[model samples]
Structure formats: structure tokens, C-alpha cells
Target: MSDRPMTTTPPRPPAGGGLFGRGPFAGAGMLVEKSMSFWPSTRRLMRRLAPERARITVVLVLALIGVVLSVIGPRLLGWATDMIFDGVIGKQLPSGITKEQAVAAARAAGDDSFADMLSRMDVVPGRGVDFGALGTLVVWAVVLYVATSVFAWLQGYILNDVVQRTVYRLRSDVEDKLNRLPLRFFDGQPRGELLSRVTNDIDNVSQTLQQTMSQLLTSLLTVIGVLAMMFVISPLLALIALVTIPLSMVVTKQVAKRSQKLFVAQWTHTGTLNAHIEEAFTGHELVKVFGRRPEVEQAFQDRNEELFKASFGAQFISGIIMPTMTFIGNLNYVAIAVVGSIRVATGTMSLGDVQAFVQYSQQFTQPLTRVASMANLLQSGVASAERVFELLDAEEQEPDPADPVPPASRRGRVEFEHVSFRYEPEQPLIEDLSLVAEPGHTVAIVGPTGAGKTTLVNLILRFYELDSGRITLDGVDVTAMRREDLRSHIGMVLQDTWLFGGTIRENIAYGNPRATEEEILAAAQATFVDRFVRTLPDGYDTVIDEEGGNVSAGEKQLLTIARAFLSDPSLLILDEATSSVDTRTEVLVQHAMAALRSDRTSFVIAHRLSTIRDADLILVMDAGRIVEHGTHDELLAAQGAYHRLYAAQFSGALVTDDDEVSGEEEVAGVRG
Candidate 1:
């Protein structure tokens, strides 16, 4: 049987309608769109930067300086334009005439408009342009632009550093959170969903901050600086440009409201699809065995299609903001241009001022467009942030006691007193179950499926806390002792063998990291692992693949036994450790387990009755209750639950004086 706890079930997808009231798997309640607290999530994300406040302040100052310099450039160029225009007009007039005399002459000729325009010009009559002054203004503008670029670059560099550091800390917190969470928490969550939060979602958050932070800051600063410059040049044109501000806000608000939901849907579908793919690949063999390829492919296609729709909708909706803002800005630009020209012709404003206002108009609208564009990115980023925050905010397991009971010595006596546990509240699986294993004795537990055998062992390891009652180890309450201390004295070997991607020597030594080479070799030899290691090309140095497929099933079991042997644990758990191996291999495994179990309290959970015939005590459990318990011979003599189970295994062979030898022969036949 699979080692997964009988009470554990696969997580079901959340239920609701999609953003459009329809989507792939809508009937199954998949791809449901969740409303997000955008501002709250965004604010929380910003708070993560609190540690870098000083550096952020420096970045802000740099950006301000850059904006100030950039805003001054167009004004300086406008002054140069006025100088050139005035010089051309003044050179057409006679020499030795003052600018006031030239304007009076135009007034006397009844050209009031021309006279007013000349009054606005800074012309010296009959004097050519001051090339030196023009050169100075042009040079100043160039210097200001270069300085602006430098400051912008500097701030960008600093902000990038801040974002990277913040993300690093966030990743560390997430990893720590995963470690502190209880096993039950993981049991309910899909592996793919958790992985997405840790890897994909966090990565998206980093990219969003990296791409949007600098650009958003710069755009906002430009809007402020350029607006001020626009008013300074011509308040009339400035007012015209400001007309579009409300319209732009309305557009952004409408588009963002819809796009935010779509973005949330996009990422939600992304996680769901990832979960399906991970589940399918991890169980690829099972899928093929059951001929579920078409069903799996169809599910993948449905989720993939939903994701595409969500992504396209998000991008398409947010994409409308730029063009719409550009249209409104173009109208504002036309209004500014026509009004500024009239003001210039009427001498109310200079041509230079009109030119400056036009440049400011473009500068103003460009930033607004950029701000709108960044809205989509911000929405997606915050969506990911909310997911990560959800993970971090999950309820953690009860912390270890401040003052734990110290285990100065371990004798491996284990006792369960009135223990009660249930995976779900309303459905009780184990109630008031009690058992005791004396020191240096083998207690075998035999049960059918769903009989709570795995859960019992899990409780011993503190993998799950009891709903009631206490467990004691060596006369000390297990809860009072630190989990690390309690587990340190216990070693377990499961039906499903696991080995990391490392050498055989390293896998064996994992049981005791501080074990010396000689100790490791001795444990391997005792567990029959040395016999196989010598056959391999590299002996103990042979590298195991991630799946441990390079070694046979029997070999993997031997390695695990070797690991347990190296620990020399006072308490050992073997949950059907030899069930998966061949009969020939089972003999060797039984011998290895016998060597490991000597002088240690061992809890053996098995389905095969023959394996526990020699056990000091045997427990027969049914429906989470110990239906019968005693020595194997006593239970068989009493013709209780153990006898029934044993008889069922042998096809109802009755126990008798003549049948005793045949029973032994039957056991041997079953093993072979």
C-alpha cells in the first residue's frame, strides 16, 4: 500500500465563476476570479522597503535634482529662440536706431499689432543676434540634459540595489515560513501551488519592482516639474493642458478597474495550470497505466486556454489607456498651440514662451501615458505579492517550549495514554487508543487499510499533534521535550524508500552526519548494503540518481536500513520496510532488521502476519481500535482477531497439533 496517510486527500480547486461569468472548467468551479485588495497589498509591499529607507531617500533626492534640471532645459532653449527671432527682425531695421524708436515708427504707420509684437520681442534695432549669448544658452541646455541623465541613472542604480535586497529578505522569510509550518498545513496544500508562490510569484514581484519603480518615480516627478514649468511659461496654455487631467484619470480608473481583475485571474489560472502539470508529471507512470493521457491532456488544454484568455484580456484592457491618453493629449496640444500663437501675435506672450509651453505639453502627457502603462505591471505585481503574503500569513505550528525537558539518557520506552486524533473534526479516526512498548522489545502492529497504523507512528514522531492525551518517551512527556531532541533518538524506515541525489556513502551517512568513515562502513556491512556496494563499479562511492533508479528496489531498502543502522537509534520504526522487495531480498532485509532491532524498542507496522510471529508482543487493530493484543502464540491460542487474520492469510487452515509443522511450511512457502 502507498505510504500516504489514509486521512489525507487531494486538494480541490476553489469554486466560483470567472471574470466573464464563464470559463474553462466553469462547471467544476475552476478558474474563479478573486477580488484583490490592491492598495492594501501594494502598501504592504512598500513597507517591505522600510529597512532601506535611508537609501530610498537618497534616490528620491537624486530624482528630484534630475527633474529640476530637465524642466529648466526647454525654458533655456525658448530664450535662445527669442534671441534669434529678435536679432533677425532688428537687423532688417536701419542702424543706429533704438528698439523703442523702431516700435514707435511701427505705431505711427498704424500697424498697432506689429508694434505690439515688436514690443514683446527683445530686439535691439539694427543690431544682429548675439551669437555669444545663443552659444551660452545652448551650452547650458546641453549641460543640464547631461546632468539630468546622470542623476536619473544614479537613482536608478540605487533603487535597483534596494529592490534586490528587499527581495532577498522576502525570499529568506518565505523559506523560513515553509520550515515552521506544520505537516498538516502541507498536507492540505498542493505542492505546485506552494512552489508557485515561492518561485514564480516571488520572481514576478522582483521583476515588477525592478521594471516599474524607477520608471514610475521618474514619470511622477516629470509630471510635477513639467506642470510647474508650463505655468511659468504661459498660464493660459497651462490651464488648457490641465483640462485633460480629469479625463485622463477617468480613463485610467476605468481601464485599471477591469484589468486588475483580469490580471488576478491570469495568475490564478497560471498556478492552477502549474499544479495540474506537476501532478501529471509526478504521476506520469500511473497516468499511463490507467490510460489517463487524454483526460490529462484535455485538462491541460482547458487550463492553458483559460490562462491565454485572461492574459490577453488583461493586456488588451490596460493597453487601451496609452492610446486614449495620447488622443486626449493631442487635443490639448492643439489647443495650446493655437492659443499660444494668438497670444504671441497679440504681444501677450513671446514666441519663445509658446515654444516652451508646447514642449511642456508633450512632456506632461508623455509621463501620464507612462504612468497609465505601468498600472498594468503594478496590478500584476501586487497580485503576486498577495499570493506570497498569503503564504507568509498562514498559521504556523505551535512553537517549541521555552524550557524543554532534557533527555540525559534514552532507553526507548514509549507509552500512549488515552490518545485521540482525527484529521477532520466531525469524523473521528482514532479515539482513546492506548498502547505501550517496553524498552528493548519488538511490538508489532497489524491492521487492515484505513486502520490508522501510519497515523499512530506519525504521532510518535510528532508529525501531527494529538487532539487529546499525551505521549511519553522514557518517562518524559514527548510534548515537554523539544521535537528535535525527541526525533534525534528515533530512526524510521518507510515502505517507500527515498534517497537524495548523492553517493551511496553520503546517503548512508545522512543518518549521522558526524559519523566517521569506519562507522559508516560498519553500519553498511551489518545491513547487507556492503554486499551490494562491492558489486557496483564504484563500491560505496557509487552515485545515486535523484529517483534512485540506478539501484534495484531491494538495494534502496538496504541503503535505508544502513542509514537507520548508522543512527543506532534507541527507538526504531519499520513500516512495511520489506514489503516491496522480492522473497530472496526479504530474507536479507529481515536479517538486517533483526540486527538493527536488538536491544532497541521497535514499532513494526505490517500487513503480513507471518513476519510478526516471533514478535514479543502483537497488536491487532480494527477501525482505529486495538481489537486484540498479546503474544502471537497467546492470540492464536485464544482464536481472537489475530487468529482470524492469520487464518485468512492461509486460506482458513486451522491451527492444530498436526498442522503446526504445516503452518511453518506454509509460512516458508509464502515467503518463497
Candidate 2:
């Protein structure tokens, strides 16, 4: 492992200057720059989901046009408000409005004295400012409002398309990565935690891009345009409005910095809670059998409470940003009103200019508040991104060397030459030991529990790497063989059978996708699994629950046997294959194993000594070493470790070479 520990850094903005401005935008560009450095992966994802760059370009162009029109149209509305007042109340109507028109409009206005007051409010002594063309401005303002509405709708259309496609592609890429990850990558990590990466983390990114970014873009554009308009109308008032901008920004940054850690904690706890729930549900039988209901419930409640506290802290901190921003905005608004009043009273600024400045101040502050809040969502998004990237960055299992030397022909022979292994380096599970199984022979291994029987099988298949020594197949080093091709020729039926949530046919066919219905039925019959399948309501079509929960342990094991039979691999590893079944089911499993191993090398780790008495070889193992090995009768004749174990099981029973029965004693039952 690297010396660096896993930790999240604070989200920084773009590195280069922003397209429109500096500060946060420039920081945002820096972030984009960092993300772009992983362009090969990002580009692949983008191309897969979007497929068409032209569509993206079109959407962005339309969005830009919409933003421009929307900004310009709102200003036209303010312009028309001033123009309408000038025409109807200030007695400065254009040529079309007569004295009769003003009187009629005044009476029709009714309780709208505010309009008349607004008209009277604008004045500039000793300044020649004509208001005769105000009627034309009103018509133009109405047109601008309609245009702005149309552009806003167009922007929505473009943004929605881009966001949905981006989400679709991101999800697809995550699923693909999950499929390609090796089995060792899954060890110790809960399925629920992995599932959250595909579901919850991606949802966070989507929410940011859709709702947060949309609001962010609008607020940014409005602030820029409003500031420019204010600067044009009165730089003094614009400066006054801009004074509060930095304070609001500082508050927002503080809120984001304080709340980000809390949000990350909350999401992490959510994953832990999910893992706990899934484990409880999956192990419900074990919990009940062990009478651990209270223990399980308390464990769940502990994780739940942690999640709740973290969420509360995060949300409570985030909620404060909006109100705090509102308070600052109101204060700035009051300052602008007072300053504008002084300037207007001194005849330095017109009423129209003051109104525009106030509007601009509101525009500036509202987006500032929006940008602040969006910072919260963006922070959450970045936190999620960090987790997802970490998963993607995990080291993959080393692949087999390239250009592997192929065998002249695959013979059912396997040899372990001084193989030693450890699940963890501090404790070795398998010592430096060697063993071999000849072609078409059955080798039965009996060992005390934790004596590494299963670990031995796991090594042969290369499910794990041996720390020392080599495993060979057909006299060739298996490590030099391609993993896919190496495993393709080996069949495994683990003690615990796992069936996906699908139909019985699907479960059996999983071993070989191209297997026909006839082939599946034959294999099922051969394994005696068809007896139970036929009793089900849907027969072969019955759907199995995850882990084969819908079926009994015996039936599930039998189906797994049927799957292995269908595969018909040359080398078979049956790791406690019938340990979960009753004697009757065990008989059927033995029959299936016998038939399957007829012409193939087989390794059986059996608890029932009676099951493997006819094996060509038997190895008695204890504490990671082969204490005794020979043919069953030869070992009994030697009267060594195997002799003592057999004598203890069938005490005083006379034995003959012709007799097929052997003592039903395994290594763990009589440890020596």
C-alpha cells in the first residue's frame, strides 16, 4: 500500500480563469481541469451515453441564446415601467396620446395611485431628458417579456436533454466496471455498499448537474448582466450594491467548508446502515437460530442513530446558508435605498436610474445567495465523486503472464508442488506441502476443521495466489496459463451453493449459456435434482430467490451439482459438496459425483468416510500437513494415523480386503 492514507481534499474550483469571471469560477475551471486529466475514461463514458456531440453543441448554443434574451427582456420591462408612467401620469405622452387619453387612463387606473406616484417620482431639474417616446418603450418591453419567456423554456429543454443523457451514460459506465471487477475485489466489502456506488452516488451527481447547475448558471448570468447594467446607470450605486457581495461570498464559503465533512459522514453512515440491514435480512435464520434478535436490533439501531445524527448536523448547517444570505441581502437593499435617496435628492441621479440600481442590487444578491446554496450541493457531489473514484482506482488482481504456453492436450491431472499460502501474511493456512491427482483418479482429502481443505481447493483454481510453490495442470505450471482458459476446464461445486434470483432453467443454464433445454433436463436427472424440480408448481420454470432461499439446502446443492454436470469440466473440485444434505440426498450426490468423475480427475473433501472408501487415493491431513496418504485399504494395513482413526469409528469390526465398507470416520471426528 502507498504511504498516503485515504482522505478527501476540499473541492477547488476551475484552475484556469472562468469563461465569464474570476474567483470561484476560476476555481471551478481548475476542478474541470483536474477531471479532464482523466479524459480517456471520461471520454469513453461520454461517447457511450451521448454518442452525438452535435446534439450537445446545439443544446449549449440554444441555452446561451435563451440566457441572453431572458436577461435583456427583464431590463426592457423596467424600461417600459418608466416609459408608461411618463406617458400616462407625467403628462409626457407621445404624439398619439391626447389630453383626453390621460384623463381616461387616470380614472381607469382607480386605486393604483402608486403608478401615478412612481411617474411623479422621477425628475431632474435643469437637465433636458425627453419622455415623449415612452409609448414606444412600453410596446418594446411587452415584446421583451414574451421573448424572455420563450428563451427560458428553450433553455429548459436544452438543459434537460444534456442532464438526462449524462446521467444515463454515467450509470452505464459504473455497471460495466462492476461486471469486470474480479472476485477478490468483492471480499469483505458488503454488497449494499457496492450497490450504493451504482445507485446513490450517481444520483447525487445527477441532482447537482440538473437542479444545482441550472440554478447556478441562471444566477451567474443574471449577476453579471445586472452588475453591468448598474455600472452603466450609476457606478456609485453599483459600487454600493457590490460592497455586500464579498461578505455574502465569505459566509457561503464558510458554510460549505463547515458542512462538507458532515455530509460525507452522513453518506458514509447511510452505506453502513444499508450494509447492516442487508446482512440482517440475509442472515435472519442464523440470527433466530442463535436467538440473537435483540443483538441484531441493537446493532441496527446503533448504525441508524449514527446516520440520523450525521444527517441532522449536515442539513441543519446547510439550512442556515439561505436565511443568513437573506439577512445580508436585506441589509444591502436598505443601504442601496438610502444611498440612492441622497443621490437623487441632490439631483445627481434620476428616479429611473435609482429604480434600475435597486433592481440590479436585488439581482446581484439573489444569485449570490443561489451560488452559495448551490455550493452545498456541489460539495456533496464532490464528496460522492471522491468515493466513486476511489472504488474505480482500486488495484485489480494481477493478470496471468502474456503468451502462455498451451498444453499439448488437456489431461485430467493436477499437481501441487510445495504449495504454501496465507489469507493474511501473519498466519499461514497451508504449509509447504505437495500432492498430486493422476488422470481419471479420485483423491479424497480428509482434514480437521480449519485444516485448510477448502483453502487447498481454492488454490488449485487460482481463486487465490499461493505465497510459495507452484500448482500445475497436465505437468504445465498453471500460473502460466490464462485465467479464463484455466478455469474453463475446471468445475467447482462449493459447500455453499449460490443461485441468482431467476428461473430454475436460468440457474442451471448459467454453467453453460448455450446448453439446450434437453441438455439441462438430462443433467438435472443425472444429479437427481429433476425429482424436486418436477414437484414444484412451475417445474423447471420456477424462479429461485437469491441464494436459492426458495429451495431447501439439499435441493439447492443438487441443482448446483446439475450445473457442474452440465459443464462437464475435466478436473472437478467438490468441496464438502454434500455436507448440508441428509443421508438420502447425500446418496444421490455421491451417485452424481461418481458418474461425473468417471473419466476425469476428482478432488473430494468429504466428512463421510463411507463416501470415498473406493477412491484411488486418500490423504489424511492435520494442521496444514499431509500426515498420512495411501489407498484406503493400504492405509488401514499400514495401521498408522488412518488405521487408528478407522479402528476408533468401527471398533471390533472385522475387516477384509474384499470388503468395500470403510469406517465412517473423518479427520476432524478423531483428531490425532
Candidate 3:
């Protein structure tokens, strides 16, 4: 890190910087709504979904059977019609009626023309009407219908399995991608927005695959089957019905091309809203203390309204597909009826055939509506896939070299040789500066907020690659080592302590998962966490809830310290490690730190004036440079920046919690 003036220009922003100005979603509400074709990109998802090709192949074949049965049912019903006609003309009734019964029934209804027609036909035995053939046709129709229903159910089952496995793979890929991405990538993103992609976007993709995308293949097959059956019934009628396809396609293409833009805008604004909610709720206490509730409510209302406009526009436009297709379908039905009646009158077609042809026309056009709706769904799914792909394809940190040096016999020695770094390329924050801490030495860093204290530690740990010079561990440059290997030798306890949802023992053992019960207890005792664990009823078995909120902030800090102790790293970095503790706990923590410092080299970033008086070395920093370095008494006798800083604290102008110097005090957590 450079020790240059801290007021230099800033560094390059994060990956998503193009989306905003200063903070996340500064002007994210405005959208560029443009319809782009989705097929080319969503095709990858299609391939991804059917990774088990044979499974999807069987699924498609079963779907085809369902479609074929759907088309065949009406035709079979037409066959039953022909059988009934044969029964009427032959003067022998089907099994439900005898010729004598039919005549009497017609006479009772006072239908003389029907009674006469029944009387004129040649009466035969039950064989005259071919009731046996009709029975067989009826049975076949029932079997076909049942099989169709079974195929539908079976297809759904297999599709669900395929979809779940594919989404499982997608989610796993994204999780691994997060680990490989550079820290700067996260610095530029909102946690909630990223989380939204993992959940909401992936869910959208899953729903589309389960409910619609998979249907594309089957829908196409149904189209082919229906058209073929229509032609077989009557080619003239089939020609008339075919007009619905192109007409509906033109309408669908026009509406979906425009509505696609609105869907994209909808999802983008949703992410922005999520980002706002995440940040706002995380700091709700600050919001209430400052009476900013009205502003927060207004922001929420504005975001919601933006989302509403996009949602309403997209849904309303795509919604036109159903009604328009229905109108066209009804028109085709009328044309088929008119044309078929003329053919029947001319004796060119059978009455039953015309009825089957009408059914075929309706069946053929219905899936047009399905396809149109499917198009809209595909557009939405593609939008979500794009967001997911963006994260997966993002630039990742460089991998370890082909050959990496492993740490030999561990040493606590660390050295910064003429190091320089800047958060912003144009603005140099730290200049050529050097420091060394030998094995078992204690180095205390004290500076105003943004005076490069945290940056120094970040560079030493190789969080951000240095712009110039090198930091080494025991004479080996840290960059030459694999990052995981380099980090393994050091442990950190930050002011913002993070504890996962697990038992206290599990959390403490996180640093060394294989630690035995005895080892864990020893580490807990070393860090003074055992004192608090004893107070809790469950002790080490006590489960910590979300963010460890069940415990006090100070207790959470001690648990983290215990975690570091279990790791037993040769080097340690503590940033305000004792800030949240009470005076009594602080005494115990200091005793623990003193004991741990005997074997490990420790770097301490301190805000309290009283915490580091006994340090082996004190580095007093101003702006970004260390102006003085010596023992406590030597710095005081020299009467430099450290002396003045110490005098301010001693004179009661600076307190442990809040310090005031030159009648002004800077708040912490600021970055240079």
C-alpha cells in the first residue's frame, strides 16, 4: 500500500460498475427495453436440461403417443357414427335397441317419418347391425383414451426428474463460481441481488422447463399429427383450416417481439428492488434513529411502481395471444363447416367424415395458442438465463501456477520491502514504505481512519495484489505460494465478527474441522470463550442462530478468537478484536492475547489508546505513511505524532468508545 496523500483519485470499480454511478443501483430503475430473439441463447439451456439424452428421448416418444391418441379419438367416434348409421339403415338396432322397440319408441314420440323409416328396412337378427364390430370399436376407443392419459402422467414424471437434476447442476456451478470470483467482483455487487439470481432466476428457468420449454417438442409433434389427420378426412377442409397457423403466427410474432422488452425490464427492476430492501433492512436501526422512514417508504413505493409498469405492460401484451388465436380458430371452424356441407350434399364426403374433419380443425389450431404462450414464457426464461450466465462467465481470479512452493518449517517472520499500493490507479495512497516483524514479535498499528492501517494488512495477506514491492513470509514471496496455502499460515479476527448457524463447538472447530473434543476445549479456554460458554446452559453444544444473534456481540467476538486459536496459525491479524467487549472481558482477552503472542507473530490494529502501551513496536501513521515507530516510552519522549496522539487520549479528549481530537472525531469503517 502506498503512503502517498490519501486524497488521490479512486481505483477501477467492480465488474457491474457500468450499471451504476457511485453505489449499487444508483439509477437502475431506468431500463432499455428492446426485444431480442431468445432462441439462440435458450438453446443452450435446452441441451443442458436433457443431459441424459435417452431419458428425454423416451419422454418425447410418450408425448407423441398422447398427441396421436388425442387426434385419433374424434376419428374413432366417427367410426361409431358409421356403425350406428348401418344399424338404422339395416332395420336392426344396436344392442341398446331392437327394431320393434325403435319403431314403437319413434311412434310414441309422434315421429311418423322416423317410424316409417324404421318399418321399411329389412329386419335381421342381432347380426344385421354388426353390434359386435361396434362393441370392439368402443372398447378400442376406451383403451386408447386411457393410454393417452397414462402417457401424459408418465411424461410429467420424467420431465420433473430431468428438470430437477439440470437445475441442481446449474446451482452448483453458480456456487463454485462465487468462490473463484475476485473480491472486487463482490465489492461491486449487492448481496441480495446476487442471491436473487441464485434463487428467483433459477426458479424461473425451472418453471419454464417444467411447464413450457419441454412442451415445445411435443407441441410441434401435435401440430404435425393434427394436420395429417385433417388431410386424411378431407383435403379441401384441411386447406381451409391451415390458414389459422400463419395468421396466429403473424399475430404472436408481432406481440411477443415487443413484449419481450417489457419482461427484461421487469426482472432488472426486481433485482434493484431486492438490493434496496437488503441494504435498507440491514440498517433499519440507523434509519429509525435518523427518522428516515418516510424517505425509505417513498423509495420502496417508487421501485414498486417501476416494477408494476413493466409487469403490466409485458403481461397485457403477451395476453393478446390467447384471445386473438381463439378468434382465428373459431373463424376456421366456420369455414370447415361450410365447405364440408357442400361436399356432403354433392356426395363427395360422408357426414361422419365431415364431423371428424371439424374436430381435427379445432384440435389443430388450439396448440397455436399453446405455442404462442410458450414463446412468451421462453422469452422470460431466457432473460433469467442471461443474468445467470453473466455471473458464471464473469472474470475469475487467476489460478495457482503450475508449480507452487509449499511452506517449509513454519516461521512467524514477515517483511514488507518498499511496498506501494493504491486503491485508485491515478491516486497513490501509499508510497515506498517498509516494515519487518520477526518471529514472536508484536506490531501495533494506530492511525486515523483511512490512513492505510487496514490496507496494510490487506496487502500483507495478498487480498489485493500490491502495485510495487513484495511482502514475504519467512523469506518466500507470498505471491509465489498458492493462495489457500498462504492464507493457511495466518488467521484473522475482524471487528465485524461473523458466526454461522451452528453449535458453538462446531463454529470453534470450523478452523480445524478434525479437532478432537479435548483440543476444542483447550482452544476455547485459551481465548476466554470458555468463561461465557460456562454461563450458557448448553455450553459448547449451544446452537448459534442467524449471524450468532443469540449471543452478545462481544461473545461472538470471543468465539471467533477461539476459532483462530484452534487453527494455531503462526501469524495473527486482529482488527479491533476487543472493541465490543466489557472492561472485565477485555482484561481476560488481553491476558489470552498476551499468552498467544508468546509463540505467534501478531499484528494489531487498535483504536483504543490504552490497548497497545506494552507492544514491542508502535507504528504511528498519518495520512498513509508511518511517521514514527518505536516503543511506547521512546515515542512519548520523542514528542512526535504518537506523543500528541497519546497526550490527547490521556487528557480525556479521546475515550475508548469515541475519541475527539482537534474538536473533531472521525467515524470508523471508512476506506481509502
- Candidate 3 lDDT tens digits, 481-504: 898988899989999999998999
Best by lDDT: 1
lDDT (10s digit) by residue, model 2, range 1-672: 011212222112223222222421121111101221222433443454356467656655655665566556546656655554444444443345544454446558773443344334442222223555565766676776677677667767777787788788767767766655655666635666666667787888677677764576677777877788888877887888888788987887788767777767766776666666666676677768877778677767777788799789878898788889989899999999998877765546655667767777887898888887666676666666655665666666667788886656667798888777766566555666788899989999985566677777878877777788999988888889887778888888888888999999999998899999899999999888898888999999999988776899888888887888888788888888887788987887777778778879999897667777889999887667777888888887676667665655555454344332343343323333
Clashing residue pairs for model 2: 13-27, 13-28, 14-27, 14-28, 14-29, 14-30, 15-29, 15-30
> TM-score of every model?
0.90, 0.80, 0.87
lDDT of each: 0.84, 0.70, 0.79
Q: Against the true structure, what is every candidate's RMSD?
A: 5.2, 11.5, 6.6
Clashing residue pairs in candidate 3 are 2-421, 2-429, 2-430, 2-431, 3-430, 3-431, 10-424, 11-424
Error in Å for residue 308 of model 1: 1.8
Q: By the lDDT metric, which is better: model 1 or model 3?
A: 1
The candidate 1 region of ten consecutive residues with least summed lDDT is 1-10
Error of 1 at 581 (Å): 2.7
**Ten residues in a row with the worst lDDT in model 3?**
663-672
lDDT of 2: 0.70
Best by TM-score: 1
lDDT rank order? 1, 3, 2
Model 3 regions more than 4 Å off: 1-37, 89-129, 654-672
